[model samples]
Target: MDHNIILFRLYIIIALCFLIPLSLLVSIQLYSLFKSYALTYFLLNFFLNNNKVNCNNKDYDTLFILLLKQQRFFLCISSVEYLLSLRYSELDPLYMLLAYCYQNHNFCYVAEYYYLKALSCSPNNEIILSKLTQVSSKLSKHPKLYTNDGLIL
Candidate 1:
């Protein structure tokens, strides 16, 4: 009886040693997931509410910075698309923002299109010109002007 009791106690201790760390890891994971979801919810609500009114550059900048910090490029793209649908007069920045999101996703063609739109709106914007150049280079392809014999047309 004494030996059985000791063995039971040892088993209990071993089980607790494993269980405790497992529970702690699970709790930490859950907490982080909850925190991320809560932040995403809050930011989405903030963005939707702000869109109801006429937002200035500062507001969009804040939202853009937050979304970028969170690495929520799709959300940024969608939000910018929604704003673009509203036909805001100062569209250069919106176009630039959309181009940036597309660029991050490696959609160089779409990024180039938006960058061109932005450049058309603000012809003197060096930043837009630079971004357009970068995307253009990425999308560029060498022409096949020479024949199989290396003869020029």
Candidate 2:
């Protein structure tokens, strides 16, 4: 009876040893997760309120090179919203700056893509219409720009 009691007590101690450490590890991981979530929330809010994150000229130049020279599609596409927020009005004769930026970035397909997008907002625009015609003409020849429907020309 005494031996059985001793064995039971040993079993309880061994189970506790494993459980205590495992519980502690789990608690630590949860705490770390909560901290990570909180930090991400704070950073997101900071960037949202700040609009533009201050970067050194060299950093700006590096990003420009990456977007324009390296043809980083994501970077060029992401800037469209910010570019559209500029002072150019829908009635203005100026070229769509976002489209121009895509052009300067050598993202001609995206530039032509945005020309149609801007036209949806300003369909009667002669400048936009002319630019669209020119871009479409260019696209007809650049087989890479054609759709699955087949070549335009």
Candidate 3:
């Protein structure tokens, strides 16, 4: 009877350990989903607002430049999420921007992932394919580094 009680207690503890954490993970994921949806709309509005401003206006142009810079940072973070397969986060724009950064920075593996992600969304994107091809050529030339760690451009 003592053995049976101890075994039952251990089982309860194990079940709680897994079940509580799984529930928390699921809740966090759901929260992130909603947050991402909201961020998508906010980003869209930000871009739209910038576009509606007069291009010839110096103040508007300055603002636009700042916004663009911020957008690039956001894109980079998002790209990391994509590379890490953390789709729970919204990082598509960051991923696209990440491709450009990788291409220029000689991070071919990261560039490849970013390019692939962009292409996945717009399969026939000529720009993405061109970048991918360029990176691929660079990678082939330096075949000594074959791991994804080197894929980041």
lDDT of each: 0.83, 0.60, 0.62
What lDDT score goes with residue 133 in model 1?
A: 72
Off by over 4 Å in 3: 1-93, 141-153
What candidate 1 gets wrong by more than 4 Å, as runs, is: 1-40, 141-153
Q: Estimate the overall C-alpha local distance difference test score of candidate 2.
A: 0.60
* Candidate 1: tens digits of C-alpha lDDT, residues 36-80: 667767766876776564656776777777778779898888988
- What does candidate 2 score in Cα RMSD to the true structure? 13.2
Q: Give the number of colliding residue pairs in candidate 1.
A: 0
Candidate 1 least-lDDT 10 residues:
136-145
Structural similarity to truth (TM-score) of each candidate: 0.62, 0.36, 0.36
Instruction: Note the residue pairs that clash in candidate 1.
Output: none
Residues 12-94 of candidate 2: C-alpha lDDT, one tens digit per residue: 99999999999999999999767755654454354346556453434333443445544554554444354345432342222
In candidate 2, what residue range of length 10 has the lowest lDDT sum? Answer: 86-95
Clashes of each: 0, 0, 12
Residue 107 deviation, candidate 1, in Å?
0.4
Q: Compared with the true structure, what per-residue lDDT tens digits does model 3 show for residues 1-153?
A: 999999999999999999999999999999976775566556545544653423333433343334345455455444344334533233344456667666766778888988888888778877777777788887884324357667633
RMSD of each: 7.2, 13.2, 14.2
